[model samples]
Target: MVFDVVCIGHLAKDRIVRGSEEYEAPGGACYYGSFVLRALGLRVAVVTRLAREDLPLFEELDSIGVSLFPVQVPETSGIENIHPDPDSDRRICRPRGFAGGFRAEDLPPGIEARLFYLGPIMPGEVPLDFLRHVASLGPVALDVQGILRRLRDGELVIAPREDQGEYLKLATYLKADDVEAKALSGVSSLEDAAPLIAAQGPREVVLTHREGVLVLADGEFHRFPFKPRSLAGRTGRGDTCFSAYLGRRLLGDPPREAARFAAALTTLKLERPGPFRGSLEEVTRLLASP
Candidate 1:
């Protein structure tokens, strides 16, 4: 079957710390984003690399009907996230494991997809040439976090790339949070950066900030406020937003409507811990709520 989206990245074994409580769980943008896409009733496939022992952690994706194409490696990549406050944005990021890198040849041939999502956890996870090759296959949706994140003395740090313009040109839809936007575009304000980021190349640039989501499309900016009652499930906020937005666009929703739907769905997702488990009806109801 032709998939609606094909996500490429590493499936991570993440150790998350919220205040004094800590637990290990499955993570990585591809892990969360693919699940949300499937839940939204889209045909999704994930191409990932992980250790043999970590392969079983993907059972949830199998149960959800997402096609998994994995590359066996020595160890599963991982991250250690320490959230100082459960409700605050500040956190310490450290690399737990490096799963090794992937090449374009690793992708299964003839796998058709409407959108190719790049969800690498760190720089070089997916190389620039590989990213460009995938863009030739279909519209590409990029999560800038992966490209900008680098290990500095074992700590995850946001590193800007000099080839930002070239990378942006390969993405049809680009998703970046406030921090990532500043790091990549060198603009401190989303208000000032969204347009500049769009001008760099993505047909639409979606920037998520504390206030809401800002989308630049067709020379106009549309803002949507997140109405989630809590930030309980904040870890995958950007992943959820980008996946849902791209799914909506593929299903023929206008750019503005897609952004709104994505924001509403993400706000709801932020209220829970895992990938969006809610149905389309639930998200619709939330979007309908005043």
Candidate 2:
């Protein structure tokens, strides 16, 4: 079957801790992004792996009309995020479990998509050859977080990938947050880092920061601020923003318009936990204002 986008990643059962408060939630770019795409009226499919016990978690995706291609492994991948400051982006990430890596057989045969989104939750979850194979299928939108962050001893460390140039060349669209961009390009400015990353091969680079979303496409830069009322749902900010941006792009919106739509959609997402639950009308309304 043909789909607007195919998301490949590991489903995560994330444990979030903020001082005296703690809770568990479903996570991963595929988990968050599929919902955003579906909400924008795009057909979506997800290829993921997790423990058999976590199979029921996919019910949410099914409810949203997202096709699932799940492969059950012995363990479900997870992370424990300890946030000492609720207002800050700093966090201590520890690996809880890893579901193992993907193989060619994991992707369903006969499935076609306009865009393939690769959003692994950690290193090794997606390998180089696998990325190359997917890129051959169609346009690829990649989130570099999973590749840049690796499990070190017991904690998650964010660092530049040794072969990032090779991987970046495979992606048509790239997503990276300010922190991740800094680590990969050795530049602190999003405007500067976006072009540097894009120089590797991606035609477009989407960079998310605490204050806004920035897009550099075809040698031009576009930006829009995220006016979230609160930071209640900050965990999947980049995932939501990137998905919203691509959803609009697929619908024929230019980089400036797509960036604005993404920022507005992501602002609404920031006011709630979990994947985006707001309507397109709401996003349109937000965009029309000011």
Candidate 3:
């Protein structure tokens, strides 16, 4: 079945530490992205693998609004070591290789979308040929951090983009934080990072600096400032921001409005402690004129 938006990636049980006992949640771009879109009033679907033991979470997702593009794999899980700091948060992500990714041949017989979001499990995890096919299907939006992020002594580190530059052009939108923005663009400041990332590929680029967020689209640049929340206990804010941006766009909001709405949504998520804790009401309230 065709979907308004489909996010394909790995979903794993995340053990995040912030306040007291370690907390657990299903974590991954596909999980967070589809959840946010469903909350935003969209028909969203997710294609991911879950171990037999973790099947209940997927069932919970289905009971909500998200449809499943299931991929069965016996060994499927991701482990994350998160150390949340006010200024710097470190996450060591390990995809057990249990999920081999959904191959192009396995895609729905003839399914298509106005939007396709691919958050790679690792560098080149989706394969260049598959990326080309997905981009050809429709406008593509990518969270490029997965391509550049690697585990360094169980701490998240970024490797310079050596060969995946070609895939960036396949994306209609590129979303990354100020650091990933610098890594992708080789620029120092967020202001400089915008043009550099836009020139790399994608018609639009959004850089989420700690202070605020910036959007470069249609030969113009726009920024939405926020009262930066103290989210010293969670991860996945970047993924949350991108999904909201696309959710608003697909719902007929203009680019500026989309960016504004996303900024507010992200701020709400920041206040919460986990990836998907913030609800539709909190985000909507944040978006209201203040």
Candidate 4:
């Protein structure tokens, strides 16, 4: 079957800790991104790996009309995010469990998509060869976090990959948060990092910072700020922003407009503690406002 996007990643069982309070939730870029794409009225399919017992976590995606191609592995991937301060955006993430990696055989045969989004949660989840295979099928929008993130002793560390340029060259679009971008490009500013990252091969680059989202497309830069009333849902900020931007671009919106719409959509998402549940009309209304 043909789909607007085929998202490949590990479905995470994330444990979020804010001081003494803690909760487990289903997460990962695929989990958050698929919801944003579907909410934008796009036909979406997810190719994910998780434990058999955790299969029920995908029911939420199924209920929303998202097609699932789940690969049951030995364990479900997860992370324990410890937020030290309630008022700060700083958090320390540690490895919980890893579901293993993806191979070409894991993909459903005869599947086709306009875009393939690779959002692996940790190193080796989606290998380079698998990324090459997916890019051969169509455009790839890659979230580079998984590629750069490594498990060190027990902590999750974001470091630069030696073969990063190789992976970047295969992606049609690339998504990186401020930290990842800095790690990848050695440039501190997102505005400077975007074009340098784009030069590696991606035609467009999307960089998300604490304040806003930025897109560098066609040699021009576009930016939009996040005006959330609160940052309760900051966990999936980059995932939501990247997916929303791609959805709008797929619908033929220019980079500037797509960036604006994505920013507004993500702002709403930040106000809530889950995948985006806001309507397009709500985004439109937010866009219309000052």
Candidate 5:
């Protein structure tokens, strides 16, 4: 079967903070990307490994008819973030045991994924070589938080990588936030950052800030700015963005259309607490308005 979006990597139990308030939400590219795509009425699949303790999450996905190519590991991984304000900004602290070390053998079979998104929660878990192999199977989308970070002074922070020169060469659709772009590409303008990012290898690159998302690829550039909605929760905004974008793109939507739809999907998700909470109706309304 053909999959609209196949998300790789691990899941996390996230401690979400908006201002002084805190809550836990389920995280992992698998959940976020697949959930939003399914919500959009598309075929979605997950190729991942989590602890057996997390089996219930799989059962939950299965009941909804979301296809799963599951692998079991001994433990589940976790992460914590402190959002300093309601402005939707955050600082993250990762626990040592987060769940994404995907062996190629562990990946599920008999499917061709059209769009592959890899959200690596831990640095060095999904090797660049492994990603290149995966991309050969499809167009790859990535959130580089995993590789762009390092353990510094015992805190999880974005630091320069000694080995990024090659991994950047393998990515197709790349995404990063303000801080992440600063760390990963060393440029301030997301568009200016795109050429540098593409110089590394991706055919398309985007930089997202609290204000909006920017896309540059195939010799074209575009930006989508949101009107800053008051959110119920925005724990998985970027994940939702990447997921929805891939979903639309796989459906043959143009890049600008795909990116705008993704931005709308994420804006709606910002009003919810978890992955899979936003719907197509919600995403459409946001996408249609001026």
Candidate 6:
């Protein structure tokens, strides 16, 4: 069946540490983003690689009506996120396990979507050639961080993409946090970087930062401030924003409107853990408020 969005990436088993508390949770761009899309009532499918032992972690997705096509591998890509403060987006990232890269053949035959979201959690996880093939299938909403993030000396580092133009050209909508945007364009600010990234080819660029989200589309720039009560669920902020924004876009909201809706929706997600559980009415209410 054709889906609204097909999320392609590794399903991660993340080890999250906040002060004295620590726990293992399902993460990765695909893991968090697909959940948000599905929760928004979009028809979502996930294509990911993970070990059989870790397959149980996907039960939440299955229960939520998300169609998951998981490829069993020797390992599941993962990371250990060290949060010094429980309410901070800042964290120390360490490489844990890597399932490996995806190939074109890994995509199920005849599966299709109106939007393809590349959610790779590490550089090279979704090979360039594979991404090119997905672009042929539909408009791509990409999380640029995965392709630009690398494991260096056991720490997570950003490596500027030498062929940023190629990837940007293939994507219809692109997402990056301020750090990733700076690394990609060598610009200190998102205002400067968003336009540069958009020029490469994505019609829309979603640049998220501490204060809020910046959306650049059709030569116009829009900013939406986030008002989360707390940052308890900061880990998936980027994933949540990108998925919710694209979901709203596909549902017929304009660029600026979509960005606002995403910011409000993500604000609620940040107050809790896992995917967003708030009702659509709640988000609509938040969007309508001053």
* TM-score against truth, every candidate: 0.97, 0.97, 0.89, 0.98, 0.91, 0.97
> Scored by Cα lDDT, where does model 3 land?
0.74
lDDT of 2 by residue, 1-290 (tens): 89999999998999988768799999999999988999989999999999888988779999989999899889999988887887666778898899888888889998899999999878788888899889888999999988898778889988997798998999999999898999878999998899899999999999998999999998999989999888778888899999999999999999999999999999999888888988999988988898
Candidates 4 and 6, the one with greater TM-score: 4
Off by over 4 Å in 3: 84-98, 226-229, 275-281
Better of 3 and 6 by TM-score: 6
Model 5, runs deviating above 4 Å: none
Would you list the clashing residue pairs of candidate 1? none
lDDT of 1 at 10: 91
Model 3: per-residue Cα lDDT over 96-198, one tens digit each:
4446655787466677777998875554457778878888888999887777877677555766677657878899988887778878878778878888778
TM-score computed on alpha carbons, candidate 4: 0.98
**Lowest-scoring 10 consecutive residues by lDDT in candidate 4?**
81-90
Task: Give the per-residue Cα lDDT of candidate 3 at 209.
Answer: 64
The lDDT per prediction is: 0.86, 0.90, 0.74, 0.91, 0.73, 0.88
In angstroms, the error of model 2 at 231 is 0.7
lDDT of 2 at 178: 90
Can you tell me which runs of candidate 2 are displaced by over 4 Å? none
Candidate with more favorable, higher lDDT: 1 or 4: 4
Candidate number of the best lDDT: 4
lDDT for model 2, please. Answer: 0.90
Query: How many angstroms is residue 146 displaced in model 5 relative to the true structure, after the best TM-score fit?
Result: 1.3
lDDT of 5: 0.73
lDDT by residue for model 5 (119-180), tens: 88777668877887887888888888777767666557887687776777777888877777
